[model samples]
Target: MRDVTIIGGGFSGTALAAHLLEQLPGGARLRLLNAGAPLARGLAYGTQSPLHLLNVPAARMAWHPERPTDFVDWLRAQGRPAAEKSFVPRSWYGEYLGARLQEAVRRRPDVAWEHQVARITRLAPHAGGWTLFDAQGARAESQDVVLALGHFAPADPHPDLAALASPRYVRDPWEPDACAGLDRDAPVAIIGAGLTMLDLLVSLDHAGHRGPVLCLSRRGIAPLPHRDNELQPPAYDTPDDWLSGSDVRAWVRALRDAARQLQAPQDWRDLWVAMRARTPALWQRLPLPERRRFLRHLQVYWDVHRHRAAPSAMATVQRLQAEGRLRLQAGRLQGVQDAGAELALQWKPRGQDALQTLAVRRIFNCTGPSSRLSQDRSGLFPALAADGRLLPCPLGLGLLTDADYHLLDAQGRPQRGLRYVGPLLRAQHWEATAVPELRQHALHLARALARGHAPAD
Candidate 1:
C-alpha cells in the first residue's frame, strides 16, 4: 500500500510532497495524482502570459520556509536577475517550484515516488486506509490522503446565461486560447473586477485587442496597487482581548482606528500584513452571524485592501482606463441576449433602477473560483458529501476540517488518515489561501503524518 497519496499535483501537493520526502519513514511509497496540469504550476501559476506577474515579491515567495530567499536565488541562477522585492512573471516562479521539487525527489531515492496523470473521481474507505479511484477504474490504496485540489472553475453566474452555451461566452478564462479569434476592434465585457480581471485585461492588451472593455462588479473597486518599494511597518501591538471579541464590527473599527495611527498611508499595507497573521484566530472568534456579516458587507472592501495587485499591472489598467479603452463600473448583471452579430448584456448600475444595455463581442468570466461547496460540479465533492465522508461548511465557504486538517464528516467526526490543504481551508482559517499560509499548513501536515499521530484507520 502507498504510505501517502496526494491527489492534486499543484503547488500545494508538490510542496507537500517535497516536505514529505524529508519526513516520511524509511522506504515509504508515495503517490501523487494530478489532473493533467503540469506538476507544481497549477492554474494560478500555469499562465504563459508574460504580463501575468506574481502578486507577491520574489524574496517572500520561497517554497521552503527555511530558505527565505530560495526563489530570488533561483532567479539569479537562471541568469534572470531580479531584486528581492521585484514582482516577476508567474511562469518563472512555476518553473522554480517545479525545479525545486525535482531536486528534492532526486536527493531522496529511499522513498518510492510516483506521479500519475489521472483525476480521482471517487474515494472509498477500507480497513487498510482509503481506496481512491480514477475515472478509468484504476485504484490505489493509501494509508493517508491529502486533497490539495486547489481552486475550482468559476461557477455559472446566471442560469440563463450558462444555458445559452454561446461561443461568445468564455466560461474559463484560464483555458488555452480563451481570448483567441476575438475581433480586435469589437467590444468585450469581463464579469468581475478582481485580480483575475486584471490578468484578463493584460492578456487582452497582449493579444492586441484594443476594443472597448467593460468590467462589471458589485463594488466596482479594483485592487489597490503595491508600492515599488514596500516599507516594513512598525510592529503592531495587539490588545489582549483582540481575539477574544466576537464582534466583527468592533474588530473593523479597531483596525480602522489603528490604520489612522500609521505614520504613513503606505504603512497600512504593512499593518495589514501583521493583522493577516492573526486573521484565522480572529475569524474563529466571530460567531456565525458575524462571520456572515463580514462576508456579505466587508469581503469586497477587505479583498481590495488585502490582495493588492502588482504596480506594473495596475499601471497598465489605469492607462487603458485613461485612454477610454477600458471602463470599470459597479453594476449587477441582469441578463444577456444574442444580438445577431454581438451579445447584448443587460445590467443595472449600482443604486439605479434604470437598466442599461451594452453590446460586446465576447464575455469572459473573471469572477475567480467558486468557493461554495454546494455549487461544486466536481463529482468528487458531491459524492463524498453524500457518503457522509465530508461536510461542507455551513456558510458555504468550503469543506469543514479540524485543526489538524483532517476532514470533518457529516456527524462532525474527523476522518482518520484523510487530510486537505489549499484555499478551501478558508472554511476554518480565513487567511489560509496565500503562499505563506499554505506552505506552513503543508509543512505541519507533513510532519504530523510522518510522526504517525493521526487516529487509527
Candidate 2:
C-alpha cells in the first residue's frame, strides 16, 4: 500500500506533499494524482497568459509561510528581485511550485510521485487505509489520501450562453489558443467583468486583437485599487471569541479599529498579513447564517480586496476602457446567435427596458470557477458522499472534514486516511481557499497525518 495518495497535485496537494516528505518516517511512499491541468499550479496559477500576474507580489507568494523569504530567495537565485514587489507572470509562480515540489521529492525519493492524468472516481476504506479508483480503471491502495481539488470549474452560464458555446465561444480561457489567429479587428464579447475579464482584456491586447470588447455582468462593479505597496498592521487585539459564533460585522469593526492602531512602517498590507494569521479563528466563529450572509452580500467585495490585480494589469484595463474599445455592460446575457461569419449577442443595457444585440466574432466566459463542490464534475466526492462514508459539508462546499482534515463520516463523524484541501474548505473556513491559507492548512494536515492521525473534530 502507498504511504500516502495525494488526489490533486496543485498548490495544496504539493505543499502537503512537501511537508510530508519532511515529516514522514523514512521510506514513506506517496503518489500525487491530478486530472486537471497538471499538479502544483492547477488552474488559477497554471495560466500561460503573461497578462495574468500574481496579485500578491513576489515577496509574499512563497509556498512556505514560515519561510517568508522562500519565493523571494528563489526569484533572486533565478536572477529576479528578492525583496521587491515584482508582478511576475502567474505561470512563473506555477514553475516555482513545481520546482519546490521536485526539490522535496529529491530529498525523499521513497515518496513515489505519480502525476495521474485520470479522474478519480471513488475511494473506499480498506484494511487499515483506503483504496482509490480512477474512472479510467486504475486503482491504488494508500495509507492516507489528500483531496487537493483546488478550484471548481466555471459555473454553467445562463441558458442563453448555450447559444454562444460554439467554435466562436471560448468557454474557458486557458485552452490552447482560444483566441489564436482570429481576425485582429473581430469584436469579442466577454461575460462577467471581474478579475477574469480584466485579465482577458490583457490577453486580447497581447494577441494583437484591437477590436471592441464588451463586458457583461449584473453588477458592473470593478475592483478597488491597491494604492501602493504599503503595509497596514492589525488594529485590534485578537478577539476574545474570535471564532465563537459571533457577528462577522462586529469582527470586521474590531479588525478596522485594530487597523487604525498600526503605526508607521506598517501599511494596509500588514492588516492583510495580520488577518491572514488569525483568519481560521474568524471563520470558526461565524455560524451558518452569518456565513451565508457574507457569501451573498459581501463575497464580491471581499474578493476584490483580497485578490487584487497586478499594477500592470490594472493599467492596461484602464487604458483599454479609456479607448472606448472596451465596453462594460451591466445587464444579463439575453442570448446569442449566428451573425454570419461572426456571432450576434442580445442583452438589455442596465436601467433600460429595450433589448439590444451586437455582432461579435467571439465570447469568452470569464465568470471564474463554479464554487459549489456538490455540483462538481468530479465523481470521487459524490461517490464518497453516496456511500455514506463522507458527508457533504453543511454548505455543500466540500466533503466535511474534522480539524485535522479527516473526511467526516455520514454521521458527521471522522474518517481516517481521507482528508481534503483547497477551495472546498470554503464552507468551513471562509479564507481557506487562497494560496497563503491553503499552504498553512497543508502544513498542519501533513503534521497531523504523519502522527498516525485520528479525527480532531
Q: Highest lDDT: give the candidate number.
A: 1
Give per-residue CA lDDT, model 1, range 276-388, as digits (tens).
88888888878899999999999998999988899999999999999999999999999998887888999999999999999999899999887676665547888798899
Q: Score residue 214 of candidate 1 by CA lDDT.
A: 95
User: What's the lDDT for residue 160 in model 1?
Assistant: 52
For model 2, residues 1-457, the per-residue Cα lDDT tens digits are 2378888877888888888877777656777888866677887787877678877667667798799878878888888664556777888888889899889978876555556676898887888788888887787788888888876767646665665555588878777677886799988888886788877788889888899988888767666555456223335345565433478777667667766876766555555665666666777777789887777777766777777777777888889899898888788887887767878889888788899999988888888876565656787666876898877756656656888887788898887778887777876776777777788888888888778632235
TM-score of 2: 0.88
Task: Output the TM-score of candidate 1.
Answer: 0.96
lDDT of 1 at 287: 84
Give candidate 1's error at residue 60 in angstroms: 1.0
- Candidate 1: stretches off by over 4 Å: 231-234, 242-244, 375-377, 453-457
Whole-model Cα lDDT per candidate?
0.86, 0.76
